[model samples]
Target chain A: MKLSIENLNSFYGSVQVLRELTLHVNTGEVLCLLGRNGAGKTTILKSIMGLVEHNGSIMLGDCEISGLGAHEIPRKGIGYVPQGRRLFAELTVKENLQIGMLIKGEDSHSLDRIFKLFPVLKERLKQESGTLSGGEQQMLAMARALCLQPGVLLLDEPTEGLMPSMIASIRDVVLKLREQGVGILLVEQRIDAVLPVANRVAFIENGYVKAEMERDELANEPDLMRHYVGI
Target chain B: MDFGPFLFLATLEGLVQAAVLCLIALGLSLVFGVMRVVNVAHGEFYMLGAVLAWWITGWFAGNPAIGFVAAIIIGPLLVGVIAYFVERLILRKVEYDPEATIVATIGILYIVQQLVLITFGPDARPVDTPFYFLIEFPWFGYSGYKLLVICAAIMLLLAVWYVITRTRLGLVMRATQYDRETAQNFGIAVNQVYAIVFATGAGLAAVAAVLIVPIQQAHYLMGRDPLLLSFIVVIIGGLGSIRGTLVAALIIGLSDGIISVFFSPTLAKMVSTLLVAMVLVFKPEGLFGSRSQL
Candidate 1:
């Protein structure tokens, strides 16, 4: 994790969001962001990744990447799994990954590593990205991001609308990412799926962090869950 | 010997005109392919090419062969250099703004035209044909210079085809056009490609002008007809398809030639327009334009 966002305030065309929000994650930590719809949970991850316009300070160690462009952010070792999986529809899976590697400026080791982590992607490497099933497409998107060899990984709604089994698989992947000492910020509507894996939790409400807790403190606090997250 | 035979000879004359027309269109197609900008001043570049050729060739007033050789070699490269500056300074920034880009090009066109008129005068100048001899075939006879232009044009076209298909530069151009951002992410420098493509296109137009200078009188205003013909060729040929442009050029050349022989010039024009309409209705993408391109 080794990541921190302090007193972060964001806006979309004068509309305020994430009012003075603050959250932190340590190394090898899976921090889940829990909220209902319009919770600005995805916005948090997007803002951190510099995908959206925002006024916030996002720090990965000594490096502060706020108000940077998406392309510039990735090179700073931050990977984003944007909502809707935004895969290049026309490009083949391999081509999509190659484009990532290309953007990251050619590392043969990263390419070989991603292919190894997602073996199914390596098998169907030449297939068009749009043809992949939901689970496979998710794997491809994650793999594309992983090719950047990011120190900080931002997963936006990774398990949204997936079958239970698929959700469990993604959950397992997130846990494995945590084990590998990757700083992960997970945005998910499926609270139960992420609760078991997250080291700490942040509840976002009305564009700010309403509550923050360690896994033990969060699991014990029933009133906070029902009041802030609607249980 | 026979007055009636003038009709047959005029037909071959028209093919010469078509050859020059194809060159103009081919250049237009090239510029449009990489830059995605329709250069209104393109005809002016062709005219400049012809004028420069005329000037350069006139340098060796007595030595016609040397002059002819000089026009082909020096005319294009010189215009290409001028075009390189115009692209870098003028058209480069306004590329995405097509309408504004056209106005800017037209501005350059007027400046160049007036400059030529001021320097060369309003009178149309007769450019000397390197070889004044006539070459007669079984069916018709033509000025040796006109035949040479036809031959040279075909060679230029072939060279252009080879460059576009066989070169590494061409691959990057095609890839960039399809998806610019994606291409850039793949380590392709798009700006360099755009400039080079623009220069190549302008160079091609200059070559066409050099070849045709001898057959027609070279004047400041001589570029309009070539401009019109180039537009027609691009329309009939699919946009950005080099093969389609060449095929369309030959078809237009042959048809215009045959028509001028058998009918009046007005009727030939009417036939060409009608054919374009038919093609538009039946195959709107020209000959080879893809669905996405259209």
Candidate 2:
């Protein structure tokens, strides 16, 4: 399945945050969205997931999912983690995961999969999710998105503000999702951390993709990397 | 004079009143704990419960004993079913908006109260206590029926505690209260939980009304006093805390009991209100509240 976003634009009341952005991710591929803060990266992801009102064409495979509500979007083969790990804080880790599965309308072995990848969650399954470290919460957030077993998974800043080791763990989790043959559209502020795992990268500026690159060829484009990523 | 006997009577009466207060207010607190709506018309559900009990007893007037018990149990069940559908049809649709909920539920309260008056007539109906033997106990002269109400209320509290602390449904309810979106993400059917919680709350209010009606006769205005007192208890106890609600109920109940024993019932109510006002001013978290946030 390919998650294709074309001419996508979103607004916060009168102010337009996302403007005519286009990007796509094929099955079993991780497509990273790169942009500085306030560059409309999160807006694009939120719009696609129907958390914000937007004008655009969002196609999951051949199906147009732009008009669907946030809750309905997951049922149509797209899962969203949302920003800030918008988890139920008072609930236990297991309950948080269970809520994601409940929405899927399918009974998958999500519990086994979550524990298999993040064994720490298994030990802390009964503990309140809010008490978990930010990295653990992020892992549960990602695991919750995956529990839906979507054909297309859209994540916004899955590894933001984490310790170096925790960031690497999340990056590893993204790679593992790719290995499981899932299509991923990852929005990130840290370009370098995601580019290595991402098969393709798009640099978004002013709600538009200013540049797109294949990860393997990015090494030779020193000027493009320096200008776009500011690294 | 004889302070021991008066104090003993007040203690017994206060405990019984507290038990009923806790039962009804717990439901109010539970609904507030999750939905954040005051459910202004919650009192009307209690009214409906008493009216249903009266209606059922009238239906089975052959043997007053059988009629009374059946009416008490069935009253709340009937009201619970009605409340379930009412929530789905009306409250659930507008649960997100608090202002809208207040207006709508207040509207529902008037509609329900008027309906009861029309059906049962304007006069307050007398519900006979099923048990006639005035169980005479040392230090307190009380009817066995009143003791029965207190015991049933305590048992209900225990059952509620078990359901909340020992069951999966209880966890979901608590989780839903603290954060709704998260509960939905975890695959918990939030709407189902809301319906069940709302019905249980309604049933509880219904039971509370029927239990106390024998001591304090049933009237169209029955919902008023309980509603006012329970709100005070819930406020002083802290919203959404069961332990807090129970504690607050006892405090208000005992104060009212003692005041009415020595002073007037009106004075007791005034004193209780004054106490609640002080709590809200100083320790808004209540006697046993864990946190300020809901």
Candidate 3:
């Protein structure tokens, strides 16, 4: 399903973080949000997940999801893997996965797919999540969200501190999700990682969408990143 | 008169105290751990359970055992329902803000205490034990009912442990305790979880009171000691650590029983308070809690 946001203004208390930013991700396409720190890229994802106060139309295939409670939003076929992984640290890997599956509301046989993607998670199922390595934790985070089998997935900085090999695997997973027809909105700092997976790049500056371009066109222009993202 | 019998008696009394205190403190610790709010009225829920047990048992004039059995089953359930409303109305309204909830629960404490004093007539009422069989020891006779209380507490603790470790509902609670926002993101009804947890906490406190009312009189002010002791247990055990709570309860309960029996009740309270101060000074996160948890 298509996910669309129009005239979305989000705020944290009195500090307005997102302006009238408009964006959308079509089915089976990965829309990457590229921006510097304090550019409100993360806020955009939070607003769509109804985790922040916002005034906007967040339409998931014409169903407005803005103003919904955070607990209610995930049940609408959207899975969010927030920054820092945010796993229940004390809980075991199996229990962490169980929380995600609880949202799916049924045993949808997604565990097999998850295990196939991250075999290490199956090995460490009984191990505490906090004890997992950073890469394993990220994989578990992605695997936890994937348990939802969501129509749209919002990932915030999934490759923030990963090794190059792990980043490549993340890219492969993103591409695979796109192939499975899951619309993805990925927030990333590395252009190299975004290039292969993101179909379209939405350049955000100061809570506003400054520019949008096809991934190929953006890859061709090196100065565009220097201008909008300052990298 | 020998030291062996006295020590054995003290140990037995301590075990009984630890059994009931663990149940009460577990509730307090769970509520504090998950909701991040100090339930100042936790003791009042305990008092209410004892008072309710007395009131409910007064109905069956023929056999006190029949009423005692009914009190054991119904007392905590009623307290849980009341606690559910209190959480939804007062705690939820305050947004579970730590400071606000403390004030709100203090208000709940006074309201409940005063209401009990007015209706229950400020008397230290007693409930009959479910059974009156005594276990004859070498030197003295011990109440079989007290031993039963210890067994019941163990069983309840085991059930609670099983639920938290092996059940989906328990996983949901732990997830909420870890990160409320993330839990909500996973479609866990966080507010509902808060209500359930708060009620369950109060229910546990009430159960402790119901079990102990047979031994101790149900006084409006009876909540004070259990409240203080359980708080000590929760803090000493490490705020949210259930394992720590149980261990701390045994230590505190046995010490209280032995000290009160040997020296004086006031001295026992002072010693426990001193221990709390020492724990706070030495280990702020508590004995079992990690530094990061604080």
Candidate 4:
């Protein structure tokens, strides 16, 4: 599966956030979006998820999903894990996962696979998600999205305030998902942690893609990364 | 009248009032709980149900039971259909905004009242009880149908509890109540859920009206008192808590019945209103309601 975007423009009320932004993610690859705060990295993901109004087309493997409602985007094979780990705080961990299954009509057997991925969730299936720790909530969010079994996953700052050990665990989960051939569009500010998992890095500034570097090129050229991302 | 028989009668009356109030306030509570939209026209839906019951019974020449049965089933269904349209057309247009929906519902209250007055006429009408058998108490006989209303209310409340606890639809509603954006992202159609919740809430109120129209005459303006009482029940019970609504309904209903029987009906209303004010001043979250995040 591939997600291709061309000339995407988004706005919040009258202020423009994303201006003619273009990017793509192929199956079995992880594309990381790196940028400063208020740089429109999250807006691009929101635009793809149909959460925000946008002008350009978002093609998810031949189908244009830009005009679809936010709820319809997930059914069209695009899963989204929004910023702040927007879990249903009052709902149980299991019920939160069940919401995704209800939409896609997937069976309970897939839950076993998810539980294997996040064993802590299995033990706390009946517990309310709001009571969980930050790392646990992040795991629940990712697991909830994965329950959709989408072709492409959009993650916005999955490890924003996690501890070091929790960050490593999240990084490992992303790498494992990559091995399973789920194309991932990850937005992150922590370059050191995301560098190991990213297949290619896209530096965005002012809602535009400033530079694109392959993994080998990023490893070889530290000055180029500093020049574009200002890291 | 002897005090013993009078006390028994008052308790029975209280139970009936509690049953009806539970049904009405449950609808209000569920709507507030899920959608956070205060339906100002909720009482009109009840009045519509009663008016519809009177109309449906008018068609049958004999056997008031047939009319009663048909009204109980058809009243709620018709109100549910009307509510579905109202939500999709009016409430949905307002984006379910708290203040906007309140104004829209108040407009709906007047519209429904005027429509009923014009079509159903301005007279208050009574529905005959389905059965005439009376329950023989030790001192006096009591209406068997009133007792049946209490039993039916218990069964219906149990059914509602089961649906909320065991059904997938309930899970979807709870998830939506917790976080609408996340629920939408997970592929739950939030708009569709809102429409369904709105319809169901109206239907529940209609059911209460159908059950009570036999005792209380159906009038175009009768919705006013029930609306006031239901708001009081919801407020004292906690705005959006179903369990709180039920408990508060019982407390208000029983006290109203006993006080009305012992003293004056006006005193009952005054005392309940005072209690509501006290609850608001002290524990705004209500006796049973937890502090809501939203």
Candidate 5:
């Protein structure tokens, strides 16, 4: 399946955040959105997830999901790991995962699969999610999203404020998801961290996609990377 | 009467008051906890339940047992339906804004009270107990119905606790309470959850009224005391803490019952209100509420 956002414009109140941002991600691929703060990178993801009010078309394969509600978007095969790892702080890790399955109308069979993906979650299943470290919280967030078994995953700054070791583990997890044929739209500030895992990269600036390139082209054009993304 | 018999009676009376207070305050806490909306109309729902109970029992004037049974089942359901519509039509329009909902529910309280006054009349009415078997103590004989009310309240509270802790519906509510936006991102229909929570809260209050209406006569004005007391319970316990609400209700109920039995009911209320003021002044997060994460 392919996730496509075309001519998307987003606004908070009257203030515009994203302007005609166009991007797409195919299954078995990682598309990294790199931009500075206030460049509307997160807004693009929020727009796709229907978290923010936006104009223009967002298509998950053949389904036009632009105007769908936030809750409806996830049921349409779009999983979201929002910024700050917004886990239900008071809920046990297992209960949190159960909520994901409950929403998807799926059974708890996928729970073992999620546990296998993030083994730490298994050990902490009964512990309140708020007690987990920052990295563990991110893992729980991702695992919660994966419980939906979505074809497309939208991750907003999953690696922010994480230690280097945690960042590496998250990168490995992203690559592993790619291998499983899940499309990932990752928004990140660290180009070096995501460049290794991303199949394609889109540089967003001033609420627009300024440049798009394949990993090979990015590897070959060092100066282009610096000019577009300031990496 | 000797002090031993008097103390025993006071203790039993306190237990009964705690039982009723727990049910009413639990409902108030659940609504405030999940939706962060102070439902000022909650007491009105309680009043509606008692009023409905009287009307339904009056239908079967000869058979008090059947009437009480039917009213117990019907009263809460009717109040729940009303609450569901209020949430959808009025609260939803205001986006469940905290201040806005307070005003909206206050309006609803007055509207409900006046409507009941018009339809059910301004006179107080009573419903007969389903069963009448007095338990004779060595010192004094007590009404079996009041004891039944205590047991019934405990069972209802336990059922509520079980549903909240052991069911998927409970998990959804807790998740929504933790973070509504995140719950929505996970494909949970937050608005639907809010509606259900609102109705359930109102329904619990209605159930409390159904249980107590046999002892206390139902009137348009009776809602005021329970509403004030439930607020005191919720405030003293913590805005959203269920465990706290229960404990606080027990303390408030028992103290009110004993003090009212010894001194005056008004004195009990004054002391409780003073306690609330002290809690607010000293520990604003409440006795059981954690320090605000903010």
Candidate 6:
């Protein structure tokens, strides 16, 4: 299944954030959205998930999901790991995962898969999610999303503020999910992190898609990174 | 009267007061916790419960028990239905904005109060106790119905606790309470949850009122004390904290009851108001609430 957005225009109040932006992530591919701050990378993902006011179309497989309620959008097999890992802080880790399972009407089998992916969650299952370390919290957030068994996963800044080891683990999870045929739409600050997992990169500027390149094209054109991302 | 028996009487009165207040405050806390909106009309719902109980019980002229049982079952249901419509029509229109909801609920409060006043009249009508039994204490006899109220409140609280902690519906509610947007991300219909929660909150208040109407009277203005006391309890317990509401209710209710019997009702209110000020200044998170922003 493919996730596609065409001529998307999103606004916050009267101020427009995404102006005629278009992007797509193919099945079994990791498409990284690269941009400077305020370039509307996060807004695109939010618009896809119906979390923002947007014009134009978001199609998941054959279904048009542009105007669906935010809650309804997720049940359409599009899992979203929002920025800042908005885990239910007071709920226990087990309860957090239970919510994910309950969302998709999945049984404990999905939980077993998640446990295989991140064993640390099982150990701290009884602990409150708020008390988890940053890495653990991030993992729990991803695990919660993955419980949906979504075909298209929207991950915003998954490895932000994480230790190098934790970042590597997150990168591996992304790669694993990609291998499982989940279309991953990722936004990350680390170019090095993107290089390993991203099959294609789209440069966004001023709420528009400025350029697009394959992974090899990005590896060769190092100056493109400095120009678009200011790194 | 001996001091021991006097004290015992005060304690019993306090327990009954606390039982009723706990149910009322828990509803307020639940509304605040789930929706983050202050429901000023909560007290009116309580008043409606009492009035409805009186109205429903009037049908069973021969047996007060049948009438009382019918009142208990029908009163809260009617209140819940009314509340559900109120939420869907009014609160949802405002998008649950904090300030707008306050004003809206205030409107609802007056509308409900006036409707009752117009129809039920302004009389302080009394509902008969379902059963006329007394528990024989060593010193004196106590009303068994009052003790039954305490037990009913406990059972209801436990049922609420189980639903919140052990059921999927409770998980969804807690998840929505924790983070609204994320709950949306995981396919939880937050708006629908809000409507259900608002109704449930009102229903809880109604249940409390129905339970207490026999002890007190079904007066349109009776919501005033319970509302103020519930506010004080909610604030002292911590906004949106169930355990906090329970603990605060006990503290305030017992103190008010004991003080009222010994001193004056005015002193009890004053003491509780002063305690609210102290709690706000010293521990705004409440005695049982986590140190999080209210």
Tell me the tens digit of each residue's lDDT in model 4 across A108-195.
6889888888889999999999999999999999999999998999999999999999999999999998999999999998888898
Model 5 agreement with the true structure over A178-226: per-residue lDDT tens digits: 9999999999888878889999998888898988989878778777667
- Give fnat for candidates 1, 2 and onward, in order: 0.12, 0.26, 0.88, 0.71, 0.79, 0.88
DockQ of 4: 0.68
User: What's the lDDT of the predicted structure labeled candidate 2?
Assistant: 0.81
Model 1 scores a TM of 0.68
For candidate 4, write residues B203-230 as lDDT tens digits: 9999999999899999999888888899
Candidate 2 stretches with Cα past 4 Å from truth are A6-22, A54-78, A100-110, A149-151, A205-211, A217-231, B89-95, B187-192, B290-294
Q: TM-score-based ranking, best first?
A: 6, 3, 5, 4, 2, 1
Per-residue CA lDDT of model 1 for A35-113, tens digit only, reads: 8889899778767766467776888887887865554667677777877776666557876776567456557787787
Q: Which CAPRI quality tier does the interface of model 4 achieve?
A: medium
Sorted into a CAPRI-style docking class, model 1 comes out as incorrect
lDDT of 5: 0.89
TM-score of chain A of 1: 0.94
TM-score of each: 0.68, 0.88, 0.98, 0.96, 0.97, 0.98
Candidate 1 lDDT over B194-276, as tens digits, reads 77877777888888888887767778998887787677777788767677777778777767777777776777777778878
For candidate 6, give the DockQ: 0.76
Candidate 1 chain B worst ten-residue window by lDDT: B179-188
TM-score comparison, 2 vs 4, better candidate: 4
Q: Candidate 2: deviation at residue A17, Å?
A: 4.4
Q: Model 5 chain B, TM?
A: 0.97
- Write model 5 residue lDDT over B55-134, tens digit each, in one string: 99988978799999999999999999999999999999999999999999999999999999999899999889888988
For model 5, report DockQ: 0.69
Error of 2 at B21 (Å): 1.1
Query: Which has the greatest DockQ?
Result: 3
Over 4 Å off, model 4:
A219-230, B1-5, B291-294
**Residue A28 local lDDT, model 4:** 82
